[model samples]
Target: MSEVVLITGGSSGIGKSIGELLTTKGFKVYGTSRNPEKYKDSLFPILALDVRDLNTIQQTVKTIIEKENRLDVLINNAGAGITGPIEEIPEAEIKANFETNFFGPINVIKSVLPQMRKQRSGLIINITSIAGYMGLPYRGIYSASKGALELITEAFRMELKDFNIKMTNVAPGDFATNIAAGRYHAPILNDSPYQKPYGNTLKLMDAHVDKGSPPNLMAEAIFNIINSKNPKIHYKVGNFMQRFSIVLKRILPDKLYEKLLINHYKL
Candidate 1:
């Protein structure tokens, strides 16, 4: 029997690419989207999923497990990008981001744990961002979402070790995706005086993403990690900027690192 892999947010971008490649690898790939109609391909099963709803999550998991009879992998790839400063975003928007980006994955992990535990093995891959590690000026809320996710990934990894379940975090720096395409999804932005900083930071991010690496690179990296004998707990891949961020985050003093990031984004 082929391994059953369920990927949320699998209609497009990196999630779509992952589903496509995993199918090629012979996994019984299942992709979920908020609008099942959008995922028209018959190559993989598409399910309706609103990541924010726990009932929907549970039902989806149960449906997949019942039909497939096994759930070998669950990749939490559904995420939203909110480009704004923390103070500027409305309270409701902040809460919403956490609900979707942070709590959404938590719900999935919790729901899948029972089955994974019963099976005695499963791989949970979370698609985080480099923003998860450290602060980025304009993306404070998105970074917060990812930071929370990183912690969840760590806790899950430590606790699930004896269960033979593996939880891996994949953090890719800016990739070519519609995340910045003036999309409708956004948390409320607070009208703080410092909101202008967020505006500048967003412009900077826009410029950088224009030159960001292709999504295929990230998809390929994920493919490799999935096929590894001993997959790592965290995988970081992408352009020189991500490499520099990791290095500077290690070698530079706190103040120096902050200065560098501020200066880089301020331009």
Candidate 2:
């Protein structure tokens, strides 16, 4: 039987690109998006799913298990983003981001682990971001959600070691994904008196996302990770600018790093 993989959020952007790549590479790809019908014409199987909905995740896994007999890789790639300063953001909006970005992936991982454990060999890749490691000025809530995911992934790596179930956290920076296309609209923070001057931040952030790297590059990176006989615990990929920033964040003093980001981006 051919190797099989299940990817969440496979309808568009990085997830969609990964699905297509894995299928072309001879892996049987089963993907789930909330609106599967929109991707009806794709060659691989696409199912409707809401990752936060345990029932949806359970049924999706059950159906795949029946068809594939053994699942080889599970990619928890479903995520959304929001941007706003922490104090100015509402509690509900914070929870909303966590629901989609944190809880959603957790639900999928919970559903897949049983099958993965039974097999004693499986790869789980969480599509985290560079934001997970370092928070940015405007995207506090989104960064928090990914930060939560990073913690969970690290814990899983150790806990699942006995079962030989591999878990990897991928942190990519500035990919030209439709991510900004989703916007995630962080509630009405502009209405806050404290956040009034930052009304233009959204436009600035969107401009950066629009001009970032292509989704195919991220997909290819993920493709390589999934195919490796021995998977890694974490991987990072992005454009040269992001790479430099990651390095600078380490070598530069705290005040110097802050000054560089403020002066360079004109924030």
lDDT of 1 by residue, 29-131 (tens): 9899888986686468889888899989999999999998789889899998876656556788878888888999999999999999999989999999898
> Candidate 2 on 1-267: residue-level lDDT in tens?
788899999988888889999898999999888888888898798997898788999999999999888888988888888876677667887887898889989888888888889999899999988877666777878878888898999898999999989999888887778888675664545467535435567777778788888888988998899778887777888877777787888898999988986675467
Backbone clashes, each candidate: 4, 1
lDDT of each: 0.83, 0.83
**TM-scores of the candidates in the order shown:** 0.93, 0.93
**Candidate RMSDs in order:** 2.2, 1.9
Worst 10 residues of 1 by lDDT: 182-191
Once superposed on the true structure, which residue ranges of model 1 sit more than 4 Å away at CA?
182-192
